[model samples]
Target: MRPFKSVPKARRGDRVAVISPAFAAPAISPAIHEQALRRLSESTGLIPVEYPTTRQLGASAEARAADIEAAFADPGIRAVMATIGGDDQVTVIPHIDPSIIAANPKPFLGYSDNTNLHNLLWNLGVPSFYGGSTQIHLGAGPGVDDIHLRSLRAALLEGGSIELTQTSESEDFGIPWEDPRALTSFGNREATEAWEWAGPRKAVTARTWGGCIEVIDEIAMAGRMPPLADLEGVILLLESSEELPSALAVKRWLRSLGERGLLQAAAGVLVARPPVSELSAPVPSAGERAALRHEQRDAILGQMALYNPQAVVCVGVPFGHTRPQWIIPHGGSITLDGTSRTVIADYAG
Candidate 1:
């Protein structure tokens, strides 16, 4: 329940441990992984240090835990970054040594399944970031998304207030790592809509919590959530995965959080841009997709109102499973000003 502590920012020549605590797609896409490493070095001027399981496929939970411990234990490493996110990081949670991570308390960057780690760190009183996957952000095609890069650079090297800007263009269509042509480019993007804000026009600043809705649902089901007292005055950020769950499903998840008193406890909420279409789902016509997205957004707002009528809510801010993501600081100060309709975070110097 204690206020989470922020880790020092990364600097030039600093060492960063890159570990794959979730999926190991990097093993199959070595080309992209290497390119990402090169980009990290060139862009940040920091060395990307990979752990044993960073590129190892089918890496056991114990092995991943060990790498996590080593990353935080190593005094040389200033920050830790996940290569990408997967579905089963929850399995690695039990094996993680809280004291080891808590004692070191270095900034950890990731999203998706890495939500497990974010929650774990928050419970341990260490703040972590909710974005920055090496494959998605750093290795995003020939050039990284400007929004992604800007948010990440600020979170990594400096610490201060960061404004969340809706991107004019964004993508969610993921390419296959196995296909030779997949690396060429598979996703398409279009102009983004402005963020929607609702409730009393007042500004509220507080630390952040929450992550991929699917993953948090799992955490809640497993009864692994932190103390409710810890979440008070925190800003809640939620996003849907590429799976693009049904509008009903999203509503149910939010309702469950409300039932648990989480939604009511937070100061404000920022819902990321959800993926309306995915590779697995049959592509809906443009009109259908837009309608579906609006339905989902409405469902979320209704659920929040049902649980926490006074909660300040903002929808369609860029983050989560979409491209041009902003790296949100887990358990760090976020200022949501309803008067200005702005969602800003003091994430880096």
Candidate 2:
């Protein structure tokens, strides 16, 4: 693999491509995507450029791959953003020409199913951000979450230490995106707990890896990852999407990580604030839903104990499937301080 190199940051006047490499939710939610584009300009001072298939519904995998190539090949586009996430992105990865991507390294940002793209960049030894889907974060109508904006600037503009802080409040459920009002608000906000850190009391900094745990399962199952030794010293960043997989499912996936030697290979682990609810999926009873997050946290700890007891682990960082998310660098440096239970991300380097 080529050595890891930082993709140039998007400057104020620079143009950024908005591509739907995964699902074409943009076509379904054009109003919301418009708001996303508006916010991209107002919040970042960068222009949002669109590709032919960015808003096309059921675009062929080849078309999506072409948009990706164009985004990177064009020097005018300093960054690429996904409109939203979908489930079938795994199919699109095969169509991507990594050589084209490696030659034109630029910051690419998304989460959820977009993990496919993030992984592609990581394997190519290019640094890309792990969060900041335009629809989810930029189109945040109440305005972007300050925590997310702060991290976005650090990664794409300012480039410095963006400390990870528990979002004081968060919402995992939202009104349907079809309604224009969904573009106006994230529905409701509720208080959240501070991060829960377990494992040894020590600090370690390494390039971060992993995203959207469920998608990672796909990556692992597809054998898309490099050798276990290549992952040594990486800090694993895991999160669940709006699908809200059960604790059993999460444990099952973690069990695979252990089997594949990922559990012990990483220097440390950071889990995002679990999305306790998934709007598009079946809703559990109120009592059951409330307990899901606790189960997920314990499941991870239990798996770690059985697999990699020494792995420093922290849960509840706001990076995925949650409003006010941090745009984490996919292969960038982050410090996990066990004593403080704080994560300081170094995006500049």
Candidate 3:
């Protein structure tokens, strides 16, 4: 495995590139996209520059790679953030110029299908954040979530050891950007549960890795992942999409990781709160959703016990498909202190 390098932090008024490495949801929802740009300026005082294919639908992998290249190669752009994630960023990998990204290392942020790019950057020895989509997190209805804003500011501008905290309240319900009513808030939040931990009380600090479970599965199946040895002693963080795979499917994926010898190599693991609702399905009753969440959590822990008995694990972290999502430093140092039951990100100073 290569040593990950820390990208310099973004300063106020610095230009940041927003690219759609995966799907270009921004094309369909110009209002939300515009809102996200405004939020970036209002919240961070940074100007967001959009790439050619950032809002183009059906952009080829080569086109996406070109946009990434353009963003990293441009000296004016201090950081790069994704508009949203989609399937098949894995296809973009082959066309990327590693030399360009390696030479001009900058903080790149996104989650979901952007996992492919995140993992690729990890292999290239550049650290990236695994959360904070402009459309999803920034343009979230009336305003951005406080937790998301806090973590993003810390990761982008203020460099230090940031302690991850679960929001006292959280939500995953989103408004449609097409409907004028989409701008109107449509969901209520519930109290957040404490993070669940397992394994002996030991301290292990290592560079973070992993992303959306479904995305990882796609990479693994396509044989595009880094070598098993490359994952050794790394902290693995994962979360599911709105698709909400059954508990049994979650177990199978973890079991496959164990079988591949990936799970046993990790020093620590963090699981994010999974999204239970999708565009096709209406939100379930509160009681039923809570019960389903518990079942999913247990399935993950059970598989971990069988595969990596000594690995430290935590669950229900507020960092995935849920609202108030946090931006995590991919391939950056994460201190998993089992005793205090806290996860801390040691971002570059």
Candidate 4:
């Protein structure tokens, strides 16, 4: 009924739990996982601790949930993060013990499939982060992107307004994580279009919500998302997954959000750049990639215009499945100034 509450900050040298609530990426790529651990410690001064199922392949939903419960229940665990995202985190949410998580609320950093967990926490009136997967961000090296690390640090350490900026360049795909060399350098990036802003010039500062649109759709369909009323004046932070869904698919997802009154309830909407291709797909030409993103952006804008014309919509924020992702606080405050073409997240660290 009221705003969500943030947990206490995780101090330097604090112990952070690394869990596999979805896919066991650590099992699939231990080398990359180990490098992520090093980054978590050497780069952030945090100790990374793994649970039994953290690296176990084919871990049961209950087993994964148990690990999550154990992470939140452990008073010594100052924070919890995912190894990487997979496709079935929605299955693991029903098994989470809300009481234990609510009782020991701590900073949670993850995105993509982990969106389900963030949505669960939002409904519990607890704030969780929307990015920072260890295997995805930390393991992609040439060092962490300054924007990503700045946002992560503010979310986990310092609590305050961190201005969001457009990444001058971004990667459409990456090398296989299984290859040890993948951890040595970040994915290749090329020049990118500047972030575009639209709608009212009037600035709106409100609690932020939403995540990987695909995950949001699944959990919403399962009747697991927060009440529609809870989103009053909320800033919607939406990004599609690495699945590189078709532009029409992206439209349908946003249309569903509009039909559910979630779009109308929002005061602002921030969309992540749509990934151009998947590792499995043939690499698209630069012009084709640009067109893909443009078409997706237009689809989103069209829906917003039809259903929630009053909402301030900003497109192409770098916080989804794309490289150089930034951390967004679920149910935390953010300022979307369409007139000024800027966004700022309140860490409340």
Steric clashes per prediction? 6, 0, 0, 1
Q: Kindly list the per-residue Cα lDDT of model 4 for residues 1-349, writing each as its tens digit.
A: 4656658988898899999989998887888888788887887788999999999999999999999999999999998999888899888988988999988999998888989998888888888788988877886565778888888788877888888888888886667876666878767788878887778888999888899889988998899977888888899998988888888998999998899999999999989977888788688888998999999999999999999999998999888888777788787888999778888888883
Candidate 1 structure lDDT = 0.86
Highest lDDT: which candidate?
A: 3
lDDT per model, in order? 0.86, 0.84, 0.87, 0.86
How big is the positional error of residue 98 in model 3, measured in Å on the Cα after superposition?
Answer: 1.4
Ten contiguous residues with the weakest lDDT in model 2: 1-10
Output the number of the TM-score-best candidate: 4
Q: TM-scores across all candidates?
A: 0.96, 0.96, 0.96, 0.97
Give lDDT tens digits, candidate 2, residues 1-349: 2369757677899998999998887787888888888887888899999999988999999999999999999989988888878998999999988999999998888888988888888888888888888877877566778888888777777787877777788878666887767877776677787788888999999888899988998987787986777688899999998877889999999998998898988889999888886676676666765588889999998999898878889988888888878888788888999987789988863
Give the higher-lDDT candidate: 3 or 4.
3
**Would you list the rank order by lDDT, best first?**
3, 4, 1, 2
**Candidate 4 residue pairs in backbone clash:** 159-349
The TM-score measured for candidate 1 stands at 0.96
- Cand. 2 TM to true fold: 0.96
**Candidate with the larger lDDT of 2 and 4:** 4
Candidate 3 — which residues are off by over 4 angstroms?
A: 184-186
RMSD of 3: 1.4
Q: Between 2 and 4, whose TM-score is larger? A: 4
Scored against the true structure, residue 4 in model 1 reaches a CA lDDT of 61
Candidate 1 residue-wise lDDT, 64-168, digit = tens: 999999999999999999999998999999999899998999889999999999999988889888999998777646567777787777778877777887788
